[model samples]
Target chain A: MDFALEVNKLCKAYKDTAFKLQNVSFNIPKGSIVGFVGKNGAGKSTTINAVLNILHKDSGEVAFFGKAMTDDAKYIRNDIGVVFDTVHFSGELTPKKLERVMKDIYENWDGALFLAYLERFHIPADKKIKTFSRGMTMKLSISSALSHKAKLLILDEATAGLDPVVREEILDLLLEFVENEENSILMSSHISSDLEKVADYIIFIDNGKIILSEKKDTLIYEYGIARMKQSDFDTLDKSEYLSARKRGLQLEVLIENKKQFTRAHPDIVTDNATIDEILPMLTKEESK
Target chain B: MKGLIRNDFYNVEGSMKLTMLAFIIIMIVLGIAGIYFPPNSYLASAVIGGTLGAFGALSGTAMQKDGASKWSRFELTMPISRSDVMKARYISFILYILIGLVMAIISALYFMR
Candidate 1:
């Protein structure tokens, strides 16, 4: 399958800080929504910065649409729309005036689509952006991102501060974007529930390392947590579980195939593992 | 590139007007000074020239503001190349210098006469 984005062995480090993106790699297949899930300092933004070339990488290969990214990769950028956690628009200009600015910047900009989004979001065209509320500003950013005929969207905490209703609207918009089957999205969000709602695949990053990258449905459905007493857990093969944690007298084991594990051992109770539950377990150190 | 330039223009619109108003006010004061003190008439032209030159600084100031503001981050995410951004800054500065030089020349001629 043709991938929309591919990153291989990407690495970066800061002289002032100990944090580094350690050999980060992932792929976004065409027509897929990939949710980049990580804690705040889990190198999500660093990985994105390296991909976007906003920050120089120590070593790695990043390809967008099968083309290697170079200094003159402006052509690739036109097809990509990005929304950062902080929405940035000129405070002095109204959304109407900002459209004039965007029209000249993007070759495939759709003015009518932009205006329609603004109207749908109830964002006044004439009001200066400085006066807009946080939710309104976020909506405006989303409108701009959709206005351009973007094939891929790279959003970093784009829905962080918005209320649930607004997030639902944005989620619906993202769902619509991927309906064309020629588009993809790499959205890094803190809200796992939102990712659960829209993402087809999930990538978990922690301490500059990618802990897990798998199909969301597979991760949530096929994989499960096997809870058992320490004496009962001792008899099971260690290789069968990805990782396990000892909670008091019980052991919570992360099994790769919950169904198979349950079939093999009918007595042990295996529960569905959520992205949220799996994330922390993966990051936690192994128990002796 | 044009879009970036246009955005910059809109951002600096109010500042540009304020700078021009300051220049005009300074010229008026210099002209009145020239009328009262004939020996300082040449000095009036110098001050007027200096005021127009000061207006040239506004473009750089505007560019600096744009870079410092949150807007810079968003602009970098756009499809435009880094060279396009550089070109936009260059165009805005060039326009600023040209306008300043023209105003200074006109003021110098009027004051000298």
Candidate 2:
């Protein structure tokens, strides 16, 4: 596969905390949007930080378009755009002044496009960023990220606090960005619905490890939640389901293949699984 | 590196202007005092030295602002190397020093006359 970004066995450890990223690895294929879903402190931000070299990794290889980050960072970084959960620019800077700062840093910065984006988002060019609300700050960050002719965009919870209307607009912009087939996005967001709207693949991380990585369509269409009695659960093999939970006399099981499960057990009912439903099922411990 | 230096300059520009304005006012007051009272001419030199010291601290303030705003982390995502970042900062510091020196020299010459 032609990948825009590749992470191999990435590891990082914090001195102050027991938290560590253990053998973390993922890939962002060209022309695709990958959703990174995990609860708080699940190493989503840590992985993104390591990938961008913001936080140094203890060991691993991060490559951008087949070029190693350590060896070709100066050249490769120009092709990547990153937006954190919070806006990183100085509060004193207006969008207009920020353009000047960015144009100098990015070789391919488009000042006209940046101004147009601000206008499109209804952001005043001359107003200081500190005065703007959280949503406006987020829009500014997205505008800056897009203005740079980047091939790969890494966004960490970029849509968390925005209203649905603005979130939809940002999702549409992301959809437009990847239309070229050469561009890709790795967005880590808590909002699974946003990911469901735009993601091609979903990678679920838990406790600093990737628990599940699969195609969004496959996850939604093939995965199923089965509610079965204790007698029926005991009759089934452990391999049949991914995880199981018990409520009263009934057992809720997460099955990997909805069609296959239904075919095998005609008497049991299996409902389609969404990312939201699957996340809790997969992350929580199975009832003994 | 040029871009990084420009950013540092922008970050400190407002405070730098205010500092320079105060620096000029102090130099002017010292210059006038030195002319009327030659015995206190040494005070002008002290003020000039003090102003330069403040300029040095102003350079550090830019870095402090960056750290406070978490801009340093964001800066790493750019193409610039770590060495380049430090070099840009030192260059900004040197520029601030040069500006202070020039103003001091002008004030010194004017007071000497």
Candidate 3:
């Protein structure tokens, strides 16, 4: 499979903080949207930054479009668009003025497409950016990112601080962007519901370590959460469960192979696990 | 590199405008004073110094805004190279200095005569 992005053994550490990204590796398939799910301070941003070379990695490899990202091959960045939570634009300049500045910067800037996005997003081209609301600012950032005719988009919490309606609109835009098989997106979000709606694959990270990376359908459909009596759980094979949590007289087990588990233990009941549930369940320390 | 330069200039556009206005006002006042006061050479230096100070302040303001907005985080993610980012900043800084130098030279020549 052709991958738009490939990361292997990525590691980063800060002097003042205990946080460290340990051996992070993942692949973003070409023409697919990969959702990066993690809690606050869970190293999602750190991993993304390392991949972009924003934070120099201690050790690891990151490749874009099959080319190793080295200081010599910096031109690969032209094909990638990026949107962050708090985007910095000149507050005094309007989107129109910003266009003039960006037009000089990007070789393939699509002025017509940018203006169309501004009109579609209802962004006033003449007003100072400071006057725009958070939603408008986000839209402006996305518009600029898209206007560059980038092949891949790297968004870090881009949906953050937007209302449901605005988020829905942005999600739709993302869907539209990937309609061409050449385009792809790697977005990080704490909002599992948004990922559930748009992502083809999901990668979950916790405490600077990747907990899981799987197809969205497999995680949603195959993974099962079983709640049962502790006495009955004692008889089940320990290897059958990925992780189990005990609550009062009952216990919840994360069955990796639900079909196999059910076939072996027909009396035990199993329920489907959502990404949100799977996140905490997998991240939570195993309690014996 | 051109994009980074444009971004930096765009970010500092308001400050640059204010700095230009201040320089113009100072030059006009100094020019009027030079006519009446027998072209005091110190006055020209003072005007140039004041304008340079204003430019410095404006640069500070722009830097503060950039820092506050966490722009480096966003900027590094773009297709531009890190060397290009550093080069853009240096070039912009040089541009600011060049603008100040021109104003000072023009003021000195005007007042010296």
Candidate 4:
């Protein structure tokens, strides 16, 4: 019941583009990692920007630790750490210089911890950020975010474009971060396998709307994909499946509960759904 | 706010050093030229004017770098308010102008002698 972050009815629109975030809402429970999964341009970044007040929302309420984010509540941001797809610090700055910068910005900045992380991650302390490779830069970003002693981390594709080994390292760091029971993470990434490995909850966004928000286990274990003939599909009730698609006279239906669906139709078979399969299946068009 | 101003200065530090180097070189050349041509002694004044102009542009360069790297957007996520960010920029701009004024004054004093 205790939530680290709560977003409600968040809406944002751009005059130059047709894309807009529509009634986007989610909650990150305390000590839980919530994976925000969406295709590119699906309003994930826009929603994150709105939450951080980088983009003005048309209508919304975003709360951190039960305190609404308002002009007077700007101090709440000190407890939140953010890492975007690219390193936001200037290329001219070295990690050593960045420490001085961050120390002044964050009230809880841990200089020794920052140095330890840099050493552990094998990031050079004196090299300019421009000289770092993509993986090294990402590692540096994560190190900075963690060193701030932030209670909540909002990472927008932080692990993206890195090699599998580096991604695994970052995931391990995240798992370690949430072990404190006072920390949480909201990571928006297109990679579902990463979410499958670490996320407790998954929120799927598509075309500026949130289509699915559920426990990762429920999605993976209870949700099922049923393949059957047209005659067999007609016997099933509409409530049994979320969406259905027709392929060469056979129908593939996305069922919400695999056990119940099988019990209801003893002959029909259902396969467990992964986050990757569930996303497209949920958004797939119903067979005509 | 201190952090923001410090970052702005860091962003422009390279260009600031280059500008100072150019100012020193120009001031030396023009100072010698002024000593030789007493009647047409406007060479030092030209160097002073050019050096001060370059210093004024350093703040703009800092802002341009922030824009290019999207640091402007990233900083919004920090604990500072929007007005705090603007105030830091203005303060840094004033500091830049003050540094230029000091250099100009030193050049002017040197040329008078």
Q: Report the number of the highest-DockQ candidate.
A: 4
The TM-scores of all predictions, comma-separated, are 0.93, 0.94, 0.93, 0.96
Encode model 4's per-residue lDDT on B1-113: one tens digit a residue: 88998888888989999999988887777777766777244766776787678898999999998987778988888888898898998999899988998999988888778
lDDT of each: 0.87, 0.88, 0.85, 0.89
The residue-by-residue lDDT of candidate 1 on A212-274, one tens digit each, is: 999999988899999998878888997888888888888898988998999888999999999
Docking class of 1: medium
Candidate 4 residue lDDT tens string, A1-288: 499999999999998999999999999999999999887888899999999988888998999999888644668988999999997888878899988998898889899999999999999999988899999988998998899889999999998899999999999999999998999999999888999999999999988899999999999889998999999998988888899988798898898899999999989878988888887777767764
The C-alpha stretches of model 3 lying farther than 4 A from their native spots are B30-39
Clashing pairs in 4: none
Model 4: lDDT of residue A266? 84
Model 4, residue B71: C-alpha shift (Å): 1.2
RMSD of each: 2.1, 1.9, 2.1, 1.6
DockQ of 3: 0.57
Per-residue error (Å), model 2, residue A146? 1.1
Clashes of 1: 0
* Cα interface RMSD of each candidate: 1.3, 1.6, 2.1, 1.2
Q: Which candidate should be chosen as best, given TM-score against the real structure?
A: 4
DockQ-wise, the better of 2 and 4 is 4
Count backbone clashes in candidate 4. Answer: 0
TM-score computed on alpha carbons, candidate 1: 0.93
How many clashes does each candidate structure show, in the order listed? 0, 0, 1, 0
Q: In terms of TM-score, how similar is model 3 to the real structure?
A: 0.93
